[model samples]
Every structure is written in C-alpha cells, then in structure tokens.
Target: MAQGTLEVVLINAKGLENTDFLNNMDPYVIVCYGSQKRKSSIASGQGSEPEWNETFTFDVNLGDLVSPLRFWTAIVVQRMTVLEKLCNIPLESVMEEGKVPAAPYNVVKDQEFRGQIKVSLSFTHKTHRHGHGMAVQEESYGGWKQSSTY
Candidate 1:
C-alpha cells in the first residue's frame, strides 16, 4: 500500500435531468473517499449542461495495486434531495497516465430514468523518502496546480 494524494477535477456535468418543477434545478456535487467529503459549488442556473471546473483533493492510502480505487459521487438538488444519480470512479485508470473517461450514470425519479452526469478524474502519487533517508526524485509537473478560486 502507498500513501499519497488523490486529485479529482470536478469538470462539469451534462444532461442532468431537471428536478425543479417551475425552474431549472440547482445542482452540485458531493464526492466522498473514506471519511473525507468535498463538494463543488452549485451551478446556479446552468440547467442540464452545467460546468463547475472545480478541483478536490483527498489524502488516500492505496492498498491494492491490481484493483481500482473507488470513491462515491452524488449529484444533489437544492442541497436537500440526493438525486438517485451516483458515480463511482475507478482510480487506477487515471492514476498513472490518462484521464477517466466520462461515463453515464442512471438518474432516477420514482424508479424511472432521469438523466446523467459526466465527470473526469486524475491521480498522482506523492514523493516519499528512501530507506537511506535520501529525498525521492521529484517530477516537475506532478504537484497541485494553483487555482485562483479556492
């Protein structure tokens, strides 16, 4: 097992079924890993095609190298109802190289299909000291990217 950081870029959501009766639904995302939970800002009136471009980080201790790491994602409306739409990310796919492809999840209301949310994820391992107490080789492009918003 390796202790490191997991980076989740909450890029955007598309084709989300509007839940509000009279207006466009206000939607946000809640991401969970172990005991850590992070949320993206609500996409005010973006309706179905909402873009967040938000990033969340979690401290992770990866146990199995062969299997994928899993996390829970839920799309919420008005911060009250938890839409039946849920997503689980396979971290191993995005751990070493490319992005996690946007996959569709079933959104349900009264047991009927509502819509979907598209998300992408990426991960990078943290540098650790060697047995000889020497610093590990650092990758120039492997740290957190600074953002102006939070």
Candidate 2:
C-alpha cells in the first residue's frame, strides 16, 4: 500500500438546476474519499453558475493502487433541506494525466438529471527518503539568498 495526498480544486459550476422555489439557490459542494469528507463555501445566490475557487486536501491510502473519490453538491434551503448529487468524478484519470479535465458533471435529483457541475482533480504522491550520515546542504531563494552546509 502507498500513501499520498489527493488535491481537489473546486473551481466553479454552471447550468445548475435551482432547487429553491422562491429565490436563487445557494449551492455548496461535498467531496468524499473513503471516510473523509470536505465541503466548499456556499456560492450565495450564484444559483446556476457558482464559482468556488477553493482547494481541499485528503490523505489517501492506495491498496492495489486504486483511489476512491467522489463529489456531490447541495443547496441550502431552510437549513440544509435541499440536496442534489453531482456525478462521481474519477481520480484515476487525474493520476495518469496530472490533472483531470474540468468537465461538466451531471447533477441529479430524485434519480433525474437536474444540471451540471464542473470541477478539476489532482493527485500527488508523498516520497520518503532515508538520510543517514550524509552532508546536508541547504539553500534559500526569494526575498534573501542564503546557503548553509553541515
């Protein structure tokens, strides 16, 4: 098994079907990987075209080298009553291509197509190195330049 970090950038969504009857819907996203879950900020009246521009991170364990990730969106109507599900965005494509295409995902409500949400996904592996009795050289960049050897 290998451990890594899954990075999700919630860019925006468009053509979302508004669930609110009286006003424009305030939509937010719910991302899940295994038992972990994260949420994006509400778009707040953006309704059909909501822009999040937020980033979320999740620690993942790959068994048989597979990732389990999914995304969903919901609109807050009278204290979180309205719920809508976006499509399950795959992570394997991101792992192979560095970044997944920001494509529109089908949104569903009551097992019916409602709208679409666009998003991008990325994955990075954590590397471990053993440094024992080796000379350490460090360098600094930007603002001020510095170097040290030990």
Candidate 3:
C-alpha cells in the first residue's frame, strides 16, 4: 500500500486571510514507489517503477494565508497534490514515449520571510502487474483513464 503525509507550515504575515485565495492555490506534492511485473495485460499502462520521486510547488502568493484557518487549508493542499500526481492518468503520448512518471513529494516555499508555509511529502510505490491475479481486457483505445485508487 502507498503511504505518505502532507503538512502545511504557517508563517506570520500582515492582513492576509482570504479563503477563496487559499483554496484557489495549488497544493499537494505526491511521491510514489512500487514494483510490478514487466508485462502488463490490462490497458491501464505500465505497472512497474524500480523507483520514483518528484516535487511540485504551487505558484500562489504565500502571504495570502495569514490567518490560522487559511494556514490549515494550505496544509491540506500540500497533501492532496501528492495524491493527484500519484494517481493521475499517464499521458498516452508521454507513456508511449517511454517517460516514466516522476514521484514528486518534496516542496519548499521560496519566499524569504518568516511564517511561510512549508510542506513535506513522502511515500512509497506499491504497484502490481495488470491482471496478475485476475483477468482483464484492454480497451480499444489502448489507454487507461485517471482513477481515484488502484
């Protein structure tokens, strides 16, 4: 099973408590790792990654989450970003091109001020061969769509 944690570190700023802005900001950086059979029968795409690690940072204004509540929201985003990246459907072109998904889980605020939010992400990949223990059919399109959980 994949395991990880998301954290949002809050900093001190002036007059910055906007829920809309906090929610709008992109948060979450996912890191995944797993091993799978080299051959795949299900059209879900490749099922093996010797190892993986990646980091995705948000472009939102850090000073916006000046309030305690907004700080918490930022933390949530940091965590969710990881899930999105891990389970995000592999681009057909990219996958076909032999580009493995990068596990992104390390994020740091670039701002030079105190009270800034810092998010730390980490996880392991636990993948399996397609239809290894069961039977599955490939789609006519030969590609898999995004799934919430695998």
Candidate 4:
C-alpha cells in the first residue's frame, strides 16, 4: 500500500490596513498530533520583503495529526484569516495548550515589502495508538540518550 502524506501550503498574506511601519513577521508551520493528550511540531520561517510576498509549503504524514482534516481546516479558516487581518505574526505565536494558532506572516496593505521569505516541511506518518497518549523517543549522538524527548 502507498503511504499517505498531508501537503500544507502557506498562501499569500495581505494586510487589512495601510501602514508605513515594517512588519517583520514570518509565516510558521505546525503539525498537531493526538487529542485529549496532544502534541505539536512547530517550525519557523522567514518573512516577505517590504514590497514582495511569499508562500510556504510543507508535507507530513496524514497520521501525524490526530484529526488531520478537522485540525487543518480550523487552521486554514480561522487562524490564517486572523493573521492576515493583523498584518503580523510573531514567532511566539503559538499559544498555551491546544490553543495554538496558525503560523503568521508579515504583510502590509500599501507599504512596499522587500523582506518576505518562504519555508517548507515534509515528514512521513506512523500510526501507533497508545490509548491514553503517544510517546516519542529521540536519540542523540553525544550520550545516546533521549534527553530532549518532546
């Protein structure tokens, strides 16, 4: 059987208001996994120039997100819209618990932006149900330990 992967793309960001101030925000991508006891994989990207716009794209295994369709839909509709309206998305954009919003990007209505950037991510999915929650283990070279076991 062929493996399934989720492809995420960051569309254009537009500023709702006009301003001369430079919005130095970058679009970020995140993958959420599990539910009731969820976890997330967050990545940061650069922003567009003061006069140019950019897009970000990423791919992930469908199984990575507990409810891939539901979660992604919410991100596309709610968070993205809000971020565009705000004109700037901070690196510390992710909120507390499972309340993290979509990655934000810098945009301006009239001001020229020569500082835009793009990012991409890709990962495979591995489905393993652990009932209560899922656990991830990572091994590092230094000491062959799972120290940063996020």
Candidate 5:
C-alpha cells in the first residue's frame, strides 16, 4: 500500500468547451480520491479559460494495487453523462524525485480532447510505525528468541 500526503495544484485551463451559450460558463472543478472529494472555487464568467491556482490535499492510504491517479471531469450535453480518465501515476517516482512540476493534462469530454489544465503534484510519505513492519528480534529472559514489533 502507498501511504503519504498528496498535494495537488490546480492551475489554469484553456480551450475548454463553452457550456453556456449566451454567457460564459462559470466553471469549477471537483477532484476526487477514493471516497474523499474536494472542489475548487468557481471561476465566475471565465468560461472556457479559467484560472484557479488552487491547492488541495488528500490523505493517501491506498493498497499496493492502487496506482497514482490523474483525474478529469466534463459534461457532454449530447450524452448527458460524465466521463473520467484513469492512469497510474508513478508514486515512487514522485516520492524519489519530489514534486512534479506544473504540467498540462488534457481536459477530456466523452473521450474527446476539449482543453488542457496545468497541474502539479507533490507527495509526502507518512512515517510508518515500527519501521513499516521490519522485524525486531529480542531475547526473552527465558533465553528464547522472539520476533516482535512495537
């Protein structure tokens, strides 16, 4: 399992689909991880191009099979449905190298490229208890050796 604190920088998005016909769409973002969710403030009247420059944090306690996530959300008026993208992030890579620099990720809708949002990620690993399960051998008063963890 991966354990750490994750920091996300919600930068700016460009070339988004203008959902509003007459007025610019007041756009916002909802970021989700597992059962937890976080939302960014609406960029009022920003329409297709919006800048948030927001930061969000998530507690990471994922299983070994869990991979880092890159998330996107958009509405398809034609389909009246929401879509998502799932790709593993190199958690070890981020942990080893430090923060991921600001980069553009595709804003997709129904699998079509709508725009791109610039984001950065940083991971702070949670200090595991008992050396994350490393064995500590101790000799008992009875002279028996035992493996124990505190």
Candidate 6:
C-alpha cells in the first residue's frame, strides 16, 4: 500500500450558530480520522468565531480503501450536539498539488447553511517498503490507535 502523510490546518470558523445564550460558546473541534480522534482546546469567549491556528498530522495510505485518513469533522455545540456539516474535500487535489490552501467551507445543519469553517490540507507521499525486516510505528490519538500487524 502506498503510504504518505496528511497535514490538516484548523484555521478558524466564522458566522457560527451561537448555541450558548448566556455567554459566548466555548467551541472546540473533535477531529476524527477513522478510529483516532483529537480534541482541540476551547476558544474560551471567542463566541461565534473561534481561531485555533493549530495543525494536525495523520498518516495516510492511498492503497487502503478505509484508511485512517478518512476523517469527518464535527464541531460540537454545547459539547453535546452535532454541529458538523458535510463538506466534500477532494483528495485528488492533495495527490496532484500536494496541498490545499486555507479556505472556508460551508457549515450546515438540517440542510440549512449555518456558517463557514476555514481549513487547509496537505499530503506528503512516503515510500512504503516491504521486507522481512520492517517496522511501523503508530501514535495514539486520545487513547485510540490504529491496529497494524507486521
């Protein structure tokens, strides 16, 4: 299987639906790529627009049909409700250009457009070697790890 790396930049979000009425929403992202998930730090009183400016990296396999890189992001509202919107991110762009510049993607709920979130992605092709003596190291995400056997 062809292996590589996928870099995700969690830029910021704007015009989000304020789920918190008493105070500004304490928004954070639960980034899930397959079984592994990473939780971002709360934006505090940032309210409708939260800027994380954080970067996350994940290993990807072009040959795996269901690689861990298959992540669907969901913005949690009140840390309970699913404020995630379905957005199509073309993996092909990463294959060709190797990077997707930071841009805004529409955020929706119940088929209604609610807001936008900006993100950027990049891919680095890594050579995979198969030999009798080989090793693969894995990282744990929030206690979740990708199962692999040598």
lDDT of 4 at 146: 33
In candidate 5, where is summed lDDT lowest over 10 consecutive residues? 136-145
Candidate with the greatest TM-score versus the true structure: 2
Give stretches of model 2 more than 4 Å off.
Answer: 108-112, 131-150
**Which residue ranges in model 1 land beyond 4 Å of their true spot?**
65-80, 96-114, 131-133, 137-150
Residue-level lDDT of model 1, residues 59-135, one tens digit each, is 87765443333333344555675544355555655665635665555545566665665566665557767566665
Tens-digit lDDT string for candidate 4 (50-91): 122222222322222234221220112223422232233321
Model 4 CA deviation exceeding 4 Å by range: 1-3, 16-150
- Steric clash count of candidate 3: 17
Each prediction's total of clashing residue pairs, residues at least 3 apart in sequence or on different chains, is: 0, 0, 17, 17, 0, 0
**lDDT over C-alpha atoms for residue 122 of model 5:** 85
lDDT tens digits by residue: candidate 3, 100-149: 33323222234322222222322222233454464232221234333333
User: What are the models' TM-scores?
Assistant: 0.68, 0.77, 0.17, 0.21, 0.69, 0.71
Better of 3 and 5 by TM-score: 5
Model 2, CA-based lDDT: 0.72
Model 5 agreement with the true structure over 1-150: per-residue lDDT tens digits: 446788888888888777667776777777776666787787877878889999999887745454455555443434353434422244555554548899887665567877787788887766544576653332223323345545
Top candidate by lDDT: 2
Model 5 root-mean-square deviation:
8.6
The full ranking of all candidates by lDDT, starting with the best, is 2, 6, 5, 1, 4, 3
Q: Check candidate 2 and list the clashing pairs.
A: none
**Pick by lDDT: 3 or 6, better one:** 6
Question: Clashing residue pairs, candidate 1?
Answer: none
Q: For every candidate structure, what is the RMSD over all alpha carbons to the true structure, in angstroms?
A: 8.7, 8.4, 18.8, 14.3, 8.6, 8.6
- lDDT tens digits, residues 10-112, model 2? 8888778767888888988898888899989989999888999898999867665564567777788878656556767667666555567667777676788
Question: Global CA lDDT of candidate 1, please?
Answer: 0.61
